[model samples]
Target: MEETLHWQPAATHTELLAGPVAEAVRALADDDVHVAAIDPGLADTAAFCEKYGVALDESANCVIVAGKRGGEVRYAACMVLATMRADVNGVIRKRLDVRKSSFAPMAEAVELTGMEYGGITPLGLPADWPILVDSNVASHNRVVIGSGVRRSKLAVSGALLAGLKGAEVLDLATGA
Candidate 1:
């Protein structure tokens, strides 16, 4: 892994990670993934990339969605490149087999995932929730994704993300 003075190292031995981030790091132990603390104010994709000298194309964004079928609610985490947007209504709704689907409310998403609104990631999500990764994201050699906290980020191989439990790579993104 590349070393940088700007980032603190993360591993099983480190316990500085936030709630959901710590769990994600532990869950991805077998993969060559790394996590680093970042300034919370710059955690958003555009700001993070610009401030860190990272390319927007190399970073992915995760969105939480709530789908309703009958009276029950189902959730899914959708990941796409920073350059694109997730097709929630067209792709996700059909795949989820739900009559209605939309972005989950911030409070509900944070409460359910145990992560901040801007930092909700696919990792450590509820086992029942599927993680839909865009095909472009899955094809990359490496990607920068949320660490389940606005204060940190995770770097991992696209294959590692594809191997995540409940992950399904599809054409989930569309040009904004």
Candidate 2:
């Protein structure tokens, strides 16, 4: 077994970790995904990568999304490079068959997905939510994703992330 990280809790850890990101990482019970709790509350992916020497391309971000459509409102758990932006207009709308797609409000992002706005990941998304991943992300053998809280992150296999419940492998983001 890989050495699991013993993370020191952040001030907001208890409140946020108990939500979506936690569920997502926990869902990897049968897989090799590992969630590491860290205390760098303000560290962006680039900073994290520089500090830990993690490659930016290999560090993925799980973005909790909600599409408020005309008749088909929906949610999605998307994974992309920490440096790139998700193609919300092109990829998400086409797939969801919705008139519009936008990032969910902070309250909704937290309440519905059980995750904080700055900290969301596919691992802990609702089982019915769709998961869209950038094709580049899928090419990596392993990647790191945010935990429900800003203090933690999950490292997982890119090829297998979509196999988890409610995950859909799609080209949903732009280049890194």
Candidate 3:
């Protein structure tokens, strides 16, 4: 096996506090990456910032789901910030068009994302999935997201990140 990164580089996964967080750290890379752990669900991006001493704007939230309209099936995994919410009823619904749209269950989410229920990252998502990224994320120089586990997160630049992930940036998400 590789010796792994010895020092904290400019871009690499951080520490492993064990559990899902640890798994995420390993998932990010060998070194130069940093990982932060906080409350579960990562529902509160601001809180995560306070706890980890990382900028909220530099953090990213991974959104995953499946869309079905008639016999057509579309898998979408979006990465946005806590500042904005995905337009589930607007874009997602109209795009999927099943009379209604809702979030996928934990089991389905995990199965579809290939990442943990609470720690789904857009980086490693299935290539076929239509990764939607918000334009807002591009405003920020960098962002953070799950390393495939709720207990861990990885930071990366918005431009470099979205491009690397092959994400399609759009006004996909709208507000309530």
Clashes of each: 0, 5, 15
**For residues 1-176, could you state the per-residue lDDT of candidate 2 as single tens digits?**
12244443322233436455544444444446555665555446776676666778888887666676666668887788877888877788777777778777778877887666566777656767788877878887888777666766666778777667666777777764
| Lowest lDDT 10-residue stretch of candidate 3 | 1-10
Candidate 2 vs candidate 3: which has greater lDDT? 2
Work out the TM-score per prediction: 0.91, 0.79, 0.70
In candidate 2, which residue pairs get closer than 3 Å at backbone N, Cα or C atoms, i.e. clash? 20-114, 21-148, 23-124, 24-123, 24-124
Tens-digit lDDT track of model 3 for 1-176: 11121223323333433244344345645353455544565435666567556665566777765667777666677767766788876776665555666677779878766667656776656666667777777556667776666655665566645564457777765542
- For each candidate, what is the lDDT? 0.81, 0.68, 0.61
Clashing pairs in 1: none
For candidate 3, give the lDDT of residue 19: 41
Model 3's number of clashes is 15
Estimate the Cα RMSD of every predicted model relative to the unseen true structure. Answer: 2.9, 5.1, 6.7
